[model samples]
Target: MAAYEIKFRDARELAEALKALGADMRSLPFFDNRREIRSVYITDVDVRAANVIKQEMLSRGGDAAVHAHAVDCGVTESDVILFGTVKQISFLADKLETMPWWGFPDTVKVLREALASFSKKPATIDLPSGSSLAFGGRTLLMSIINLSDDSFHSESRTYGNVDVAVARAVEHAKDGADILDLGAESTRPGAARISESEEIGRIMPVIREIRKILPLMPISVDTTREKVAKTALEAGADIINDISGLTFEPGIARAVADHNAMLVIMHMRGTPETMGSMCIYSNLLKEINDFFDEKIRTAISSGVDRAKIILDPGVGFAKDYSQNLFLLRHLESFRIHSKPILIGASRKGSVGKATDSPDTAGRLEGTLAVSALCAWAGVDIIRVHDTKENKKAVMMAEAIRNADYA
Candidate 1:
């Protein structure tokens, strides 16, 4: 089943979108008939286009409801809510393109693109090094390689110890891990930030070792700084797992763009030092969605290829324990962006709280619990320290959700 919805570049908030995954194996839309048509909300519509759109939709067996002020000239801006089947919307799309004036052509383009995005979401991503990964088809594990000594998970902290780091990387690979994410600077709350040079120094040897030993493995350099990212990429890292979503450093986007590398953009409210204090939000999910929307625009405008981008909701970066649990439960809502989502809730404080395990290392069960649920929710990537255990959870949940018992 396919859904019908409108997406505008500058429109204000619309109603709650009807989005979720089902066992039917149907694509984006749920259904395409009069009995199951979806609503398209368009905010910030100008008077000229609003009137034209209202009349046009009405003639095509659908109708647009507009604010009353649009007719009386009381309000300069009009918000129009259109309801129709996919076929009827297609008719309006065609009719709008042929119109000579009053912003119909632009509206036509927006409508067409929105409809396409809403209908089909490509799950495979092409990497920069001439490879591609298919997501939403199977569960992929991204093992964490925290290179900072002050990392919350003591077991994962290598503290720039190359020998220890290499061993962990090798262990993760042997544990059926699909990917390795090497992070030099710890983003744990109140953890000290390292300089760019120091960060590069800490992770370079580990990245080099991984590339030399496991040349086929995909390595992601998890840093927000462009200098470290570029250096790491030069050292054979294929992806930039930016915690700041390219916000901390303005140059990070173009660096990834220039390298033509893969990008994993995670969302966080503030810096690690400040995030704990600023964790409050009126609506956590909606704000995260808005953050993704803004970052996507910024990335594209800064020359990033959309296909190479992935999303992570930043589970414990700024969120409290309850909020983190809420995000994992409704993880499906983040799918609206049509990008692969990475859940890095491995041994975070939230997991510790959930399982009543005060120590981060003992939260393996709690971590696997989130991983299994995310796999069931169709999340593409699960970053965890316990690769083997998380893999089991993912496979078991996937077996039930996808009916792949074997």
Candidate 2:
């Protein structure tokens, strides 16, 4: 099965004409966005029929283009087509040479078609605030401000007095943080637990102060305790970043649901203290996928709106070095849930192992590298300790990724 992307001014009209010419109408739709318009996904049979249609469109004063390629068997069985208003079209066909003959044509066709479609309509993603999260758009940087002193990275610790914590939040906000993630308990491996009272006391004052300084900026409280979450929400936090997927604290889901707050559900193997030891997995990707599937269902059951939930693979939380890298490389897989994916690999232990940097402060370059990779993978949010560095990396990545579109 081969696919092709056809670009034209009147995508819907062209799509209708293609369907009239025996193309699959149901399979092709005009991809629309703020920038341009396009239609995509034409099969091999449709591409063959599209040649005549292309000529007819050109003769009728409608500008159109066709990109056709064969599918590859190794990576994908069927060909793909992307029809849009794209300026330049290219693909990694050489990488697909090892694919089976049955797959190569369709795979090639899909790329060509998608590239053609890109000319019609560039892809765009909308954020919760109705802002575009597309490539080249304004990148929102979420700074990691952990109130726990025992967090894995010593630099992430902000266990000072409320004044100090508030100062840190102000500094991050001043340094270009679009969102602040305030966490009370240390989610670091084998960290000592804090009482709910301690957690509330440690976080609430800081949250309240930060809100006073930056009321319009979004504030996220990273906790799994119902009481702490509710307290922070009442204190002016805008979102709940639960690493446990709301399983550790059953009432968190209900509280967040009831409050209509944005919720970030991260996938973790177990509690932080037990996570390092629970790194084993039969299929890492599938396990994470299944975990999110169930957690999403649970969130919805608890009265949370489906659109308010964001999925995080919880990189470096429980996985060993290799698994963390694998998750980062295949980060886009989580998009299957159709929700925004947030990645927090800032100054993580995995980077320590990869770059032989024992100190988190020395891992800024590595963290930026991972942030750039996440941006390339279309991750919606990147939680980082160095907001300035992450924001710069995101800007560069977005610029490079959307160079053609711009």
Candidate 3:
């Protein structure tokens, strides 16, 4: 399966593949109909204002439900579950401010923030290195420079050689990679964890060499240990891409906070060695979104700047193929958190499963397909091995996505 088969070239070809997969978009009338009606659960709402809130929601094609027996018993507090579109919720937040009951004398602060998270999401992130990348404009590519010999994708592996890694870094930078990610520790399922000293030994030279050549290149060190993160940042790496989300090393967040470097908090269930067997989620997307909220708050509490944070939903990390597809399809939905999103699906097992391809070498086109979708969905960063090919695909998709703008 070293040779990747070309299954689809154009929309017709893609449609044919979808047809074979038991999906016919032409017959599916709901393709372009996007209605996002979110349910907001407001706990311990003053029961006195329940009627007013219920009336206000119903006026805007929404509804707020309280305990069915609350009105009769005159309960002082009731859980309010309001269902409405993002626009309707924003308006309702404002409406509640003037109701003279739940409305405060000064401003409706809590409701404003709750609704704002969904309505006015952010489109860009500022890094500590005085650079910023705006999402919803173009797709940013991060080329993979794996210093580990046992990474899932053999092509991405540099065989633990700094020279080969540096050469690949130069090519990635030359091919318009917006960032270069150097990973010394392999996060592939069941891969053994390396010592912090060994990991630094493997990557510090490559990081320094890349910085010497591309001084302004954004370099991210992928690790789950604090000492590795500290030494890597001090050695010139710009971002700490922690797959554990600060659960592995308790002090890693502090290390990133102390250096004021950028953070990539990926949502993985367990260590690489344990994650494969831990591929279970009661509600995949909800659990991930909730995890992101908790982790982001934890990072902020640890003193890491919120503006420097990026999110990767951890594709293929403790996720099955169908779950990975769901995450990819809803990448745009994460915009509600107002942070940059980076998805690294390059040559992963899910892509191989999608295209009936085998191994990392056979998933190039499948990976390209994901790059196009991420670009179209306004994902901030795409980490890939084939930087040049992905750059072209993302650039074209971005151009089309922004073609109507003046």
* Candidate with best TM-score: 3
User: lDDT of each prediction vs. the true structure?
Assistant: 0.79, 0.70, 0.79
How well does candidate 3 match the true structure in TM-score terms?
0.78
lDDT of 2 by residue, 274-370 (tens): 8889999977877887788789899899998887787889987789999999999877456556676789888888988899998887898999999
Q: Write the per-residue lDDT of candidate 1 for residues 199-273, one digit (tens) a residue.
A: 988988888887778887888889999899888878888789999987898688888888888888899977988
Q: Best to worst by TM-score, what's the order?
A: 3, 1, 2
Q: Which stretches of candidate 2 lie over 4 Å from their true place?
A: 1-139
Each prediction's TM-score versus the true structure: 0.75, 0.69, 0.78
Greater TM-score among 1 and 2 belongs to 1
Q: What TM-score, to 2 decimals, does candidate 1 have?
A: 0.75
The digit string of per-residue lDDT tens for model 3 on 297-361 reads 99999999888888999998998888889999877556657788899999898898889998778
Q: Can you tell me which runs of candidate 1 are displaced by over 4 Å?
A: 1-123, 128-131, 404-406
Q: How displaced is residue 286 in candidate 1, in Å?
A: 2.1
Candidate that beats the other on lDDT, 2 or 3, i.e. the better one: 3
